[model samples]
Target: MDSQAISVEILKWMLEVQCKEALVPALLYEKKVRSQYGKAENVQPVKGVLSKRALQVNAPGRDIYGLEKSTEVRYFECPNCERQVAGHRFAAHIARCSGRGRR
Candidate 1:
């Protein structure tokens, strides 16, 4: 073995003889060294199988304002904004649109 390896073994042995707490530092160093130089595999991420259409809840449920989910409602696309506002809130939404108010 090289001089560095010999000294490492000697240091570890001395720590073991000095006190029980001294061995903790040597053990932690050994763990870190092994982790840095150990053989490890290249990992790849997996893609989920869920689609956007599968996530919508079309079942009948009442909103806080007593609005039924199954009822037909109008939706408006703002001329100056990217948001698609519901019919009831479209007028208010267009009045306060970020794209319309700010330059």
Candidate 2:
């Protein structure tokens, strides 16, 4: 094969390998989330004024259970404005605005 053809073949193989590697981890995560939350029937949508205490952000870290902790912190979201504010300031921002709230 010509040099250009050989380079193209190598590039194609690299792309295929990268795609497969990326896909495996994503599929695993999807399966885990589904199994964890899928069985809960009474899960309610978050509502009311935003509270810093109400929000939870899963910091990427290990937990005591030896499981990689999914959620490490909490924050609030505004469903009305679709604004995502982080930390304690989100609560104050929600309080001042008349928008619909979520957590």
Candidate 3:
């Protein structure tokens, strides 16, 4: 595996399953890794708003999690139903929706 590639578990914990102490350092390291790969501009977005680099730029050497502002509802279109599903629940929605024929 490439050294820059993050494991699914780490990525999941960092982005989804909460907890910030580990996330803060992980984000910083992800930035460095992306920079090395020439993808420094967008390692990944924090809540799809600010890029990892932007977060660092906005608050140097501080926890970016503290700076997170109000989050907006994000939706994804379900291919099977042509319905919008909330991002957080899209996985479950898609799983169920995919089994049904399109209306």
Off by over 4 Å in 3: 1-69, 100-103
Give the runs in model 2 whose Cα sits over 4 Å from its true position.
Answer: 39-103
TM-score of each: 0.26, 0.36, 0.31
TM-score of 2: 0.36
Clashes of each: 0, 7, 0
lDDT of each: 0.73, 0.71, 0.73
- Whole-model lDDT, model 2: 0.71
The residue-by-residue lDDT of candidate 3 on 8-73, one tens digit each, is: 657886666466776888999989998788664545534758766675657744545545454688
The candidate with the higher TM-score, 1 or 2, is: 2
Per-residue lDDT tens digits for candidate 2, residues 19-92, read 99999999899899989878436756567755443333333354444456655466667765778777657777
Top candidate on TM-score is 2
lDDT for position 45 in model 3: 39
C-alpha lDDT of residue 74 in model 3? 91
lDDT, residue 39, model 3: 67
